[model samples]
Target: MPTIPSNIVVYNLITKRLFSTSTSKNMNYVEKVRLLDYWKIQDSSLQNEFPRSHLVLMVDRRLLVTKDTPDVKMVEHSYGDLKQLLGEYGLQFDLSNSCLLDALPADNDMIPLFGTSIEAADPPEDSPISKSDVLKQLGNSLGGRFTDIRMAMLTMQEERQRNLLAKFQTLTKWAATYRRCPKCAAALKMRTSKSGAECVTCQKVYYPTFSPVSITLITDPTNEHALLVRHRGSAGGVFTAVAGFAHSGESMAECARREIAEEVGIEVDLIQSLDMSQPWPMPDSSLMIAHVAIAKMDQKISVCPDELETAQWFSRQQVRQALETTLSDPQLKKLPRTLDDRQTLHYIPPAGAIAHQMIRRWVDGKIDFHNSRI
Candidate 1:
């Protein structure tokens, strides 16, 4: 999902590589992982070439993770090791519950990686080992704890590891939800490649996909201030850029323009795509496309009660201060009493989020809006 296919022949809006003119120098992009190359290997070839692959274990959307001082790591297990470990607890580890995630190169060999969900074991009534107890025992045995996917994504310091986690969560969710084909309601089997599922009855194929969303940070023509909005049910004082899903037959740039107009009742000009994006898997799978736009001279905002609670233009200095402030639990509580309040402090999305990166780049003058035009 990071890179578009070389032979991609699709909608005009998605055919291009989606290259952004402005790449931030301060951002550390994910490295050493090519999504297209990983999926290129056929399923049969992957199994024959690499019988023992690495497994990322998940239980109820929580990942098995361990902390190493300043860094966090996901626990990867070999096929035999995971099978034996799960067997000890009367659980199954096989293709029925696992999905192909990626193939990463290690030394001269390409190690296949899989995302697996551990289902609860059904014990007899007389058995003393409860499912919770078994899970606890498993965690203790692995010397790691099961952390929520969102928390793990936020805590992971390595970009490659974070991306892998996102991929695992997204793919597993896709597989779990689409077990039957829509055409005939027949059972679907996993495809050998990263392509997705195939229906046995009707010979239908379904590929794992993420919803495309455009997140735009609107700023004044002078670039002195940027606009942020608080959604209806978002956490206290958490304001983010205007964002909405890409409508069918519309390009991402068009989505940005329409979302800005609909969310804040203001038209924008000079829209520029940022050279960064993120695959968000929480709640659902989504590719967050980032953009920066300059609002027209008429800065008056009419808040959309349905989508946003309030929208306001914050000065660059104020936004920078908010970015620098540590948004701990205590800090968030004391920032602003209400969602619409214009207090001395404000809070934006945290690290790991595309919105945060976009806002940061703009504040640091990394997004060169001078050359960016419609």
Candidate 2:
């Protein structure tokens, strides 16, 4: 039997969207024909079609945006607009180096463009051109700023747009990483269908891969407190549920238990799985499978010093307070100076994260940790 049931709805920062999933695929036959025409023309030459209003440009991993005003403005340049901007930076504008991130179903003219510079020279290995330096130059040329992709995902309001951005990032990264065949040392070319790469020499087709990870929140036997750990080099004062990549040939339940034991030296009985899964883009694309577990015999945690900085059990009340702390604005809210004997500088994962969702569910009486314990 599968540890994670099929009916469970996986939760994660990027997976939960406010908009319906069908929004991206709602085009009619006329629209489909129009899009086919656009692609046909685009395949021939970028000069054939008129430029749209917005273009989402990604150089390496950063996004070009305008941050001069209070609200950050993403740079959505039309083909002509982007062409002019690239010309100023001594970059070429080629359709071969660009792709559509997403198209608007409502407005036929509102197509989102994603472009990367294919002609830029590879920097030397010893002293490569810094990502910051490249972004600075691009920002200067475009008269805008560049923001990290993670930051952009956090601040972007439109759910559909965020989903599109993730797809773009995932596809672009896959292309860069799989430029050569793994089976044989041969160059690979994108398939005509644009779904995967095919090796020129061996003719092996390779598709994109997504890593699966298991993330769990373990509660004490009494179910009054939850175990949270701080990873080494994590942002100051922030702590989240324990997580690790699923090992080869291991079931999700087996991986969850092993990761819990390996990371914090705590034995846990597998409890009911959380219905939420999230797509984590950092450190590469991964599917985060979340679960709830209860500490078996040993409630006391022994932190793996190399992997985690600290491991502690926070009372349900404390977890609630930490969630509140994360949601409150810095200037408007004031937290207690101290809770019990510890300083009140606790910072939990952001509300968008699956970890935060698990904590919130536990606090809200939605997850019956004690009753669900194995």
Candidate 3:
């Protein structure tokens, strides 16, 4: 049987290989590695001498990728490479519009390639441009189709690159949205030492924000079946585990129980933390804390029309089969028609998603309810 790649392994490999080249005579390899782990270049002027080759250019929210098989091959370009590409496209690199995502180890010997967002000015507000329209414009500017960041994250093989891209996207969005202080309406300036903005008027600093969400796979008391739900607004015929954002003061477990009850009108007990989390960027930036809980009281489900379109309990055998079908083809697949016309063949969430991971764990008998507390 094949096994999924662990996120920890991918993360470590990315950090190690992101800048593995030998340093200059003045710098040792150990120092370079340490710098890579600890450094963040904040000075804009110092970026001039930074190597262009190591830079990851994010134009708008899309990264430059090759138009080839797998379709997730990202282009690793240096500053010179970027200049040439921009010249060919009749565009210029505007530093004022760019920001440092990460800096290199040595003082001015910055490897600016770590994280950078370089793009032309954004369209004015009230222009009402759709995402597809923006992507089309970017594709023209880059000489290749601009893939959505979410799609790239899903298909990309390099976990490190994917994570970096997500961070870049999040940072870019944060910078744009928090240009002014929320309290006093004062213009916020970027702090030179870290990824934060400070207000000149109120002395308030604004950093990137991430919301917490709870996603759970609920099983019957006997653990013989799992609950699956179809969201009213979900794309495709896909069903997923019950999920909801954690309220301002709610615990993750409390959020999980509340979400289950509110979405499907059922109570869940024995909520055991899966201790697995994933950064989800869609709709908003959030950390999804995955969990497994047992359905308490009756098995009957009363779906909340506003929250879910359908809710049903699938037996362990059915869930295992579903996972097998999903694993065989990572893309959405359609099964043969059944007598029940209302029940269509639906796909599960992609593998990288915490929801899918939780389901896979449950299907593999890796999740234990015996140790769970009420």
Q: What is the C-alpha lDDT of each candidate?
A: 0.72, 0.65, 0.68
Against the true structure, what is each candidate's TM-score? 0.79, 0.71, 0.76
Off by over 4 Å in 3: 1-41, 44-53, 58-60, 66-73, 99-110, 114-145, 192-194, 333-345, 371-374
Ranked by TM-score from best down, the candidates are 1, 3, 2
lDDT tens string, model 2, 242-325? 999998999888888999989999888655578788776676777788988888545567888898888888888988877787
Write one digit per residue (lDDT tens) for candidate 3, span 210-306: 7899999998888878889988756445668999999988899999999998999998866888888877777688888998888853767998998
How big is the RMSD of model 1?
8.3
Taking the tens digit of each residue's C-alpha lDDT, what string does model 1 give over 1-374?
A: 21335444342223112212212231122322333343333455455533467788987566888844456788888888887877776777666566676655544434568878876756678988886676677876766777778867765767778788878888777777888998899998776544578788886778888889899999998888888998877666677799888989998889999999898999887688886888888776888899988886566899788988788788899888878763453124455665346423367776767787888888898877766554
Error of 1 at 371 (Å): 3.6
Best-fitting candidate, scored by TM-score: 1
TM-score of 3: 0.76
Worst 10 residues of 1 by lDDT: 15-24
| Candidate 2: regions farther than 4 A off | 1-54, 65-75, 93-100, 106-144, 154-161, 191-195, 329-345, 369-374
Residue pairs clashing, model 3 = 52-78, 52-79, 53-78, 54-113, 55-113
* Residue 3 Cα positional deviation in candidate 3, in Å, after optimal superposition: 50
Q: Choose the strongest candidate by lDDT.
A: 1
